[model samples]
Target: MATQVNPPRGMRDFLPVEKRVRDRVLRVIRAAYEHHGFEEIETPVVEDAARLHAGLGGDNEKLAFAVMRRGLEVDDLRAAAAPLELADLGLRFDLTVPLARFIATHRSSLPPVFRAIQIAPVWRAERPQRGRYRQFMQCDIDIAGEPGITAELELLAATGDALTRLGIPDAFIRINDRRILFAALDHAGIAPELHEAALITVDKLDKIGPAGVAAELAERGVDGERLLATLEAIRAGESTGAGGTLHGFDAAALEPVRELLAANAGIRLEFDPTLVRGMGYYTGPIFEIAHPDLPFSIGGGGRYDGMVGRFLGRELPAVGISLGFERLVDLVSLPEEEAGETVALLVDKEVEPTRAIAIKRDLVAAGQTVRMQRRTKNVTALLEQLAASGATHFAFVRPGDTAATLEVKPID
Candidate 1:
């Protein structure tokens, strides 16, 4: 008996039609990024385990697909008591970490402010569900060496434009600042040490609701009431009547981002006091792309001013936004007819093979998707094959005295 073969769990095999849809979506995304002056770049799918464990990826660090040391165990591993000691490299869980390493190594050769577009697959060891996979594609755009809020604005605009191009309607951006979050925690009497615990809880507000998040925070030894009060105070500050500053929350820090969002058409930007994305590297502004039809954010990213500096030995402010390519493909279905019109050339075996090849080349050069096949004895079988090929217009060809003449007709 032969062993059965299958794709690994949480992975998929994309057939021709499925691949076409993915490619079309990616083309739209790439065009949007390129139009905004972002140059495309690629990084390796794997990275040093140390870089992945560098505390920048937040929860994604735990989900990294680690690769074991190939030949010999290091001295650390030879005497180690744990299996994790054997890992020297790991598959990248996200594009940002590798981008940081890329920038650190290539800084002198690159421009001062670099806008990059990276579209690639990343691996994670997570449970697979609809719109979630262990091996998935991330479409990322980042700006390095930009410390101002304009980076955030441009990221949001380009991302929003991409979604719009993909025919996603009623898209909105939920905006927040890490500075505001920390201040709210402080005003709520949460100690510096407990801020992370509280932030993690608050990040689940949409998933579990306000009461659920508060209950979870209390279980984690947080003062839930004070935290809720602090959140309210921050929201109050954003309102029309509140004073310039409340509870040390700097509303001014977000004013520029807010103004930019307001001016952009088709963008419904709102101040989300609870939008604490799990990534610890976010130093300033944070945002999530929201749609009316979905309960979860389709995409998110924020300012990670300290991430690249972890490698570069100096402060390098950067901001990035990621489009959830897989999730978007799930939400937006491409029409079957949009794939392309396939043209099938049924060539008689008696016809000169060179003529058939030449016709195929000509049709291909003219941008028609042409597939050449030898004529079968049964007309019905030939039609079946053409139908299976998804050929919209099929033709029967015979080498004439002068040229190959085609009797073309609709597939139907």
Candidate 2:
């Protein structure tokens, strides 16, 4: 017996119909980004291990898919001091990091402010679940060299337009600035060093709830009561449809963001005080797109002004938004098959082949899809085959017809 073959775990093989739907979705998404003046770019699927494990990718760093050293480099594994030294490169977990490296490497040749659209597959060593895969596509748009809230506004606008075009009915763009979060922690009397520590716990607010968050913060020896009160106050604030204010951060700080939201009609904005986007690299405003139907974010991104500096010698402010292509695809309806008229040209075995060819040419010229097939006495089987191939119209070229005239009829 032969061993059964299948796509590797957490990967998939898309059939023709599936690929069609995926392509259509990609087109819609690409148009949205391109319309915003973003040019497409591609980077290597493999990236330096040093960068992958550099603690910049947030929790995703723990899930880096390392590519083992090969050829002459394989010898180093035997004498390497640590696992990190054994592998030179690994599959990229996200597009943002690679984009930074790309900018640093190609800055001189590229525009000072690079607006990029990266649509590619990224690999991660994550535990796969429904709507989650080890290998999935990410559609991202990032603006490098922009140092203001205007960058965040443009990123959100492009992202929101894309989702709307894709037919995602209702979604909330939950916005929060990391600066505000840090200020809130500072006001709560948390030490500067423990700010990230508290944030890591607070990031689980959506999953664990305030009580769970307080309990975890208490275990960390912080004043959980103080932190919980801060969160509760912000959550209970006035429902402005746009996001409300956090305690320590003055509401005036968000005036620019609020003004941007008011002018951008059709954008459902909400200032979520507890919205802690988990990524460590997000320097300023961070946001996530949430729909009531899905348990997870369909898209999110934020300003990472320091990431480029970490690679390049200088700090270059940048902001980006990424759509979860896999999760977004799951929410939208698949593209339906077009039901255009099709003609299967069934030529009798004894008929001159030119007769059938002429009929097919005529049908094709008339804007109908035509498939040439040999005529068979088994009418039932022939009809079944035509129906299976989705041929809506079929034609018969009989051997007795001297003029090669074809009587084309509806498949029904």
TM-score of each model, in listed order: 0.87, 0.82
lDDT of 2 by residue, 38-146 (tens): 9999999999999988888999988888877776355676678877777789999999999999999999988888899999999987787887788999999999987
**Candidate 1, overall lDDT?**
0.83
lDDT of 1 by residue, 329-399 (tens): 87876455455778888888778877778888877887879887887889778887677657788888876
Model 2: pairs clashing at backbone N, Cα or C within 3 Å: 243-270, 243-271
Q: Supply every candidate's count of residue pairs whose N, Cα or C atoms clash at under 3 angstroms.
A: 0, 2
- How much is the lDDT of residue 229 in candidate 1? 75
Pick out the ten consecutive residues of candidate 2 with the lowest summed lDDT.
238-247
Error of 1 at 76 (Å): 9.7
- Winner by lDDT: 1
